[model samples]
Target: RLPIKWMSPESINFRRFTTASDVWMFAVCMWEILSYGKQPFFWLENKDVIGVLERGDRLPKPDLCPPILYTLMTRCWDYDPSERPKFKDL
Candidate 1:
């Protein structure tokens, strides 16, 4: 099981997993890689992560992450799962 911080909000709220969930997690992984393994939402407790996401908050871009890459990450975290980009496009 993945940590809550890496989970898409829909999956956290509804226990529903889909290709979009994978896309969300992939973006978290990308953030990890770019941030040198830093945890996503490191400042928030696991239980609180969901509420933040529900409010449309996303992981802040790492200082060194490129703008284009950060844009991709944000797209992956879109609230509407259908709006998230597919892996092939990433």
Candidate 2:
């Protein structure tokens, strides 16, 4: 299982970490786990993460990412946060 960066029922601690946000994080962790701890988006510029997130961007799927999981990741990072899926369903 992935580690919890923050925990709260109503709100996650980080400014951007909600249940949906955690699902996104989980998607990344799942990639890492499947790849034996491989780094993700390593080539992405440092600014890219923030730029994409602020502008509602998503990371490109890594080669090893399975189709089902990729679909879930896309859901997690939906441009409208409300459109993101709940962690419970994941």
Candidate 3:
């Protein structure tokens, strides 16, 4: 469904797609993969996700996600797209 749960903050606010946004979506994908396809932000609707993210809320690490992997995931979800790590750095 390409839900809001997979969107980066910049992607949400500015409607711009970039490598950083791709990183953010990929991190969500990683979370989904590690969680065995569990939905990201299962409780939130599309409209709510933007405000939640603007408030600095992010997906919690899945129980199956390794701590080190979760750390990298959070870096990919950085509020500022420019601050996100490059794919090469991952």
Candidate 4:
């Protein structure tokens, strides 16, 4: 089973998976890497992550994360898949 923690909003909500979802997963993985493997949404249950996203919240930028890179991460988490940057553009 895929880790819900790494799932995109679409994948979690409507079972839609696409390149954009891949982008979201990549961003999350990057977040983990930058945070020294800290788990995303560590205090929330698997189901709660979706609600958090629907409420327009997201994983906070790490204190040490560069602003520009955090911008890219937010882009990957955009609610609308079409607005996310393609892998080629990252």
Instruction: List CA RMSD, all candidates.
Output: 1.1, 5.6, 1.2, 0.9
Better of 1 and 2 by TM-score: 1
In terms of lDDT, the poorest run of 10 residues in model 2 is 4-13
Against the true structure, what is each candidate's TM-score?
0.94, 0.62, 0.93, 0.95
Off by over 4 Å in 4: none
Kindly list the per-residue Cα lDDT of model 3 for residues 1-90, writing each as its tens digit: 556789898777788899999999999999999989889988998889999998988899899788999999999999988899999998
- What TM-score does prediction 2 earn? 0.62
Which structure among the candidates has the greatest lDDT? 1
Models sorted by lDDT, best on top: 1, 4, 3, 2
Model 1, position 33: C-alpha lDDT score: 95
Question: What is the TM-score of candidate 1?
Answer: 0.94
Residue-level lDDT of model 2, residues 9-63, one tens digit each, is 1222245556666666676677667667666656565434455455655566767
How many clashing pairs in candidate 1? 0
Worst 10 residues of 3 by lDDT: 1-10
List where candidate 3 sits over 4 angstroms from the true fold: none
Better of 1 and 3 by TM-score: 1
The best candidate by TM-score is 4
